[model samples]
Target chain A: MKDFPGTPGTLTGLMLRVGQFTFAAASIAFVATGVRFQEFTAFCYLIASMGLQVLWSLWLACLDAYAMLAPRDLRNPRLVSLFVVGDWVTATLSLAAACSSAGILVLYDRDLGNCKESVCQRYQFAIAMAFMSWVLIDISSLIMFWLLAAG
Target chain B: MKDFPGTPGTLTGLMLRVGQFTFAAASIAFVATGVRFQEFTAFCYLIASMGLQVLWSLWLACLDAYAMLAPRDLRNPRLVSLFVVGDWVTATLSLAAACSSAGILVLYDRDLGNCKESVCQRYQFAIAMAFMSWVLIDISSLIMFWLLAAG
Candidate 1:
């Protein structure tokens, strides 16, 4: 299989993982700082999901950094398979969390006319960060999938 | 790769597709019959997502049936790639839709204490069906991904 920019062990891959970690962390930060985010199940779920993403991405980023420093191959079939599964699972959870949080925010802001509250903007920022995290993970998953397929 | 039960061109694959279609259709039916699902953007998003799932699954089901009747091969690499992409896209959308709808339902029923309304029950049923549909599609997508990797 032809090597791609974001293939495992590459600098691009490390950057992708860092990006995912940053966004997920930001998501959790926003939600945690917001008032009464725990009151809504969706926000809580978002926090949990983003927390997982942060951990997963941080772990992978470390691996990627080590691979870059060691200049070792990271395309072993089993390793790639593991990456694919992990990426897909995290991607799904992140997307679901973001969507659910966004749904609740929209319901409150538009339907119930509650956007005037400062917390709504915080929720929106958190959800947007979650979404950005999801997008990065989705890309990573797709690339891992393609790599596995080509292998 | 060893052949699996739910591999494309197999009876299990057909059954999975049919299951997805049935659940998605039922979700839409429940939501459509309920009062003012359009009032909330989340419910409308659920309807739209499930409607897409219904069409996608129905079309795939028909193809599966035809393959079974003809005993035709359905494991072409390109075709499997297409299936992987389609299944992944639909699965993500279905899950997001289900989660978002469920979030709204939870907010209204538990947090807001609105479960006494009959419409709440209908929405719950619809969200349940959506979740069921997502489960089937998730299975299908995973299988497709495995098949693509093995191809």
Candidate 2:
């Protein structure tokens, strides 16, 4: 099998995990700061999704740190399988949540024209952050997927 | 690395690919049948996403079928890496589109309360199918990721 740059337990992998965690956490914080987010189911779902992502990414980051400090490589088949499943699930949920929230934001801005300047700007900022987080997760997910496939 | 089920080019993998294609096609069909879906950006995005999914899944299914018929292991690192990237990209798009469309559906059903029963049901079905497609793709993605890591 060809060696990949971001295999689990490596410094590259640790950095990717940290990126995922930071982006997801920031997305949640931005959305939470927005006023009246709970009024919409999509917004609530986005929070829930980002919360899950934060937890998952944090756990993996800790695991990556441990592996980096330890001697043994952590790219065993069973463990990588577990990581793949977790990453895919979280990635799916995060994308779904982000997209749904954006859809509603567009509706408010374009269709209803009800979003006044301040609140609408918050919504757009939150949604954009969520998308950024999703992009990070997607990249991580793809790397993990590649590692597993090459095995 | 221990052998895992649903490796690319296996029977299980073929079934998964077929499921992805079927659900994505069904989602597009349902949304296309619905009246006024073109008016919403979310719906249009959903259609485009599903269309991409159908093409990707179908291509993979054909590849799987050929591998099954031939004696090749079809677990080549390069090929699997390509599959991983394709699956992740399609999976991300599918989930985003589905979630956004679902958000609009929720807004119409709950907040605005303007959806007629029939149209609402159609919209709900289309979104549900889109979700189904995402689930299948997620499963396939997880399997592919595991295989690569194991290598």
Candidate 3:
């Protein structure tokens, strides 16, 4: 086995840090700029999801360390493939959420519930799914990792 | 170094097949038996998510080939780790969603919109998130995988 100059562990650590930083910056920006009760509330939820997701990403980064340093001897190859694929899913989901959070801020600017087919309203389903799904998947994935680790 | 007995070339293919199967089965079950208009609608949504999720799982399964067949020098550790960790996240999310989906189906039976308890309401939010989320993540992950492969 080989190790990167910074160690494979640090590479993931960097990603987690950047993800957290983006989420934090977004939250601050949203609160400072967004208006309306629902928009504000959704912004808060978005922040909450981002916060949780960063932690989730970090946790998986650590697991990557484990998989490299100490993958189970009798691991299922199919499961390993599944694990990698799911990581992409979560990261893309996170990115979707980041874009949606921006969209949410836009919706707040326009107050789209009072309007229709506005950019925010048009993709609100995707935007809303972005944040809400992040939370749901984050919590669920955390549980799954714990189980896999324990098992 | 080692390959699984049967590795699917594209999780994309599997996801499509699973989506189709889930839709057909869920739809047939609903139509052949009986369901309220609202249940039918929710079922429709569930079927969409469920089918997509099947593809997501297959995608992860397919990634195993990269892990097994790629030349050692050409393999990128960071990229490989990303693939494996993603598989873990998606699988976990699927398991969590399977649990949540079952719960939501029950709530759907009881009428989710009318619920008043804060916890129940939260679960409603959580389940709705689960349904849309797994599917969204599935599609987004595939796109990202393609972009990375293309880039």
Candidate 4:
């Protein structure tokens, strides 16, 4: 199997994990800090999903850092399989949360005309951050899937 | 590699594909028939995503049917990789569409109180069907991923 840049236990993989964690945390912070976010179920779902992403990415980032520092291999088939499953699950949840929140934002901002401009902006920013996190997770999930295939 | 029930060219796989197609079509039918669905971008997105699912599932179902009747091998590594990628992409899109639509439905039905009872019911039904389609796609995507891993 050819080595991929974002393969688990590598510096690149650690960067990707950290990126996911940062974006997810930012997303949560943006939404949670705003007024009335808790009133919307979609926003709450986004917070929950991003919270899960934060934990998953933080855990993996730590693992990747440890593996690099300890000079350990992280390509065991069982471990890779676990990574693949976890990434897929998180990627799916993250995408769903982001998309759902975006849908609600669009409704509130455009069609419904219920949201204040400032609140809408904040929600949009949070959704965008969630999407950024999802993109990183999606990439890492694809990498993990390919690694499992090659293994 | 152990044989899985939903591998791309098998009878069970064909059934799964058919189920996905049927549910996606049902979702579209329910939403499209309802009045004012086009007014909501989330509903439109759902229609578009389910349309893609319908086409993809129908194409693959035909392929699965042909492969089974002809007794052709469909377990090539490259072919499985293609299946994995396709399934993952469609699964993600399907789930996003379903979830986003559901979020909007919740907003309309619960928070905003703008939706009429009958319309809300129809929309709810359509979203449920979309979720059904997503579930089947998720299952097949997982099977394909595992197939790639076992390959």
Candidate 5:
């Protein structure tokens, strides 16, 4: 496919693909675990992740659509705005998922009974670090996109 | 002080610092449990993780030093070569550390002579996730850098 939002599209695609695989893996785990413990909470988080990813993906697709459709000489700010929307929403979800995962861990430790794993503790740690990683990427991406837009 | 390779440097710093803390935490268990048990292998992996992290932290520092003192604009392809070197080395070490952590987990499970809570497993899983996250970031960053450069 032709490039859309220039460099920002690459970042978006990378993030979305990562989200896709992560959610898919989590779903597989949910299926394999037998009982539906951790399902509601994890599913909520997974859907959020995938929802943001799909929106971002569609935005890119539309950006592509616009790029292909816009007149060759046109220089519109709307395209850039489309990307920024994706950037911030992804950032918000990235932050939310991380925070909620931590909160869920605390609840689990208190024996809320939504999850059962001999290693449930590890999920909290895993999600927290994953959140940090995503935030780093999201923020840097926002900066880079804004700079490219503004510069 | 400026953000040269911002994502790479920041994530590396976070991983190295956290990984070291994990190493120390695991070390206490590994040592307290004595050297013969396979959690000692976990200890060994911790040390290995620490050693590799130290190298990464140094390399990132060196890149900063080189950028600041080498009298070169970072836009120069030659100057940007640092990212490639750092990315490859980081990818290799990260994968190795991840694999070693997995091995340690198996060994720890098999040799119950060690392991207090599942806490150490959290350390193992978190650091492994950290390393893997950075590797994904590294690969994507290079691809983004290349595409941006190419365009």
Candidate 6:
């Protein structure tokens, strides 16, 4: 897959998965750290969405690590198909959650001026992290989608 | 694609593409009809995202129509890759915009009790349409991802 730099089961694959996991976890942490995020449905949804991303990325990262140790090509068509589907699903969910949360920030913090400066900063930070995670997820899905096709 | 009932150059594909276009357009129309949607960046983003979806889906629907009339396989790997990438990108953007807008609705209408009946209903309708569009997009992406892999 031209989109993906490392073949499956290699160190590159492991690193890619790890990057996904780390970003997702960081996004979740930043969002969770915000005070009273549970008060808003969008924030809660963001947490749930990022939580799913974290789990998915962690699972894949572990799989990649195992694959690395085994030194096996994780390019089996069926497995690739599974990976493609998983990546797409997670990518969709993550993007949705991040964007929705960002909307909230824009509405409350920017437009309405409801949030104070300090609180607004937190929201901004969390949403920024979420977007970062989303970028990673999108890249990963693009690669997986291509790999599934080309494999 | 097991999930997709239509072949690329068949009525099913044409129908699917039409479905995508209709839902995306509907989502955009509903959102656009809302009062003061542009006041919020999230709502504006929603409009932009849905607008893109409408264009992509409409374009693909036309291609599908052409393929049906011409009765070509439309299974070229490169073309399939392009379709896969396009579908995933739109899917990601649409889902994000929809979810973010929904988050605003939930926060303002449900949590804060800001919007009253008529306006709240409009927001709800728009968000629902957006969600409907997202479902179609997800299904299409899933099918395209699978097709690219299989092709």
Candidate number achieving the greatest lDDT relative to the actual structure:
4
> Where is model 1 more than 4 Å wrong at Cα?
A1-3, B1-3
Summing lDDT over every window of 10 consecutive residues in candidate 3 chain A, give the lowest-scoring window: A1-10
Model 2 chain B: worst 10 consecutive residues (lDDT sum): B1-10
Q: What is the lDDT of residue A74 in candidate 6?
A: 77
Candidate 4, B49-117: lDDT as tens digits: 999999999999999999999988788879888988888889888888898999998877776779998
Query: Residues A65-88, candidate 4, lDDT per residue (tens digit)?
Result: 999999888988789889988998
Q: Which regions of candidate 6 fall more than 4 Å away from where they truly are?
A: A1-7, A70-82, A148-151, B1-7, B70-73, B77-82
Candidate 6 per-residue lDDT, tens place, A56-143, comes to: 8888888888876776667787887788778877877777777778888888778888888888888788778778877777777767
Q: Which digits, one per residue and each the tens of the lDDT, describe model 1 over residues B1-151?
A: 4479888878999999999999999999999998877889888999899999999999898888889899888888788879888998898889988988988988888877766678888888899999999999989987888787666
Name model 2 segments beyond 4 Å from true: A1-14, A59-83, A111-114, A141-151, B1-11, B62-78, B147-151
Q: How large is the interface RMSD of each prediction?
A: 2.0, 2.6, 13.2, 2.1, 12.7, 2.3
Between candidates 1 and 4, the one scoring higher on lDDT is: 4
The segments of candidate 4 whose C-alpha lies over 4 angstroms from its true place after superposition are A1-3, A113-115, B1-3, B77-81, B113-115, B148-150
DockQ of the candidate models in sequence: 0.61, 0.50, 0.06, 0.56, 0.03, 0.59
Task: Give the Cα RMSD of candidate 1.
Answer: 2.3
Evaluate candidate 2 and give its CAPRI docking class based on DockQ.
medium
- Candidate with better TM-score, 4 vs 5: 4
Which portions of model 3 miss their true places by more than 4 Å? A1-16, A31-33, A36-44, A54-113, A116-151, B1-20, B23-151
lDDT of 5 by residue, B1-151 (tens): 1333342334443344344334434433443444343323433544555456556555555554555565433444454455545554554444444433443443334333365556555545545554444445344344334433433
Clashing pairs in 4: none
Report the Cα RMSD per candidate. Answer: 2.3, 3.7, 12.1, 2.4, 10.9, 3.3
Q: lDDT of all predictions, in order shown?
A: 0.89, 0.83, 0.42, 0.91, 0.46, 0.77
Looking at model 5 chain B, which ten-residue stretch has the lowest summed lDDT? B1-10
| Per-structure clash totals for the candidates | 0, 14, 19, 0, 0, 1
Cα error, candidate 6, residue A126 (Å): 1.6
Q: If you assessed candidate 5 against the hidden native complex, which CAPRI class would it receive? A: incorrect
List, residue by residue over A11-130, the lDDT tens digit for candidate 3.
443344344445444443444343442433334545554555556556655655665566432134455345445644564445444443443334334433444444344334434444
lDDT per residue, candidate 1, A1-151, as tens digits? 5589898889999999999999999999999998888788888999999999999999999999999899889998899989999998999889989998988998989987867677888888899999999999999998898798777
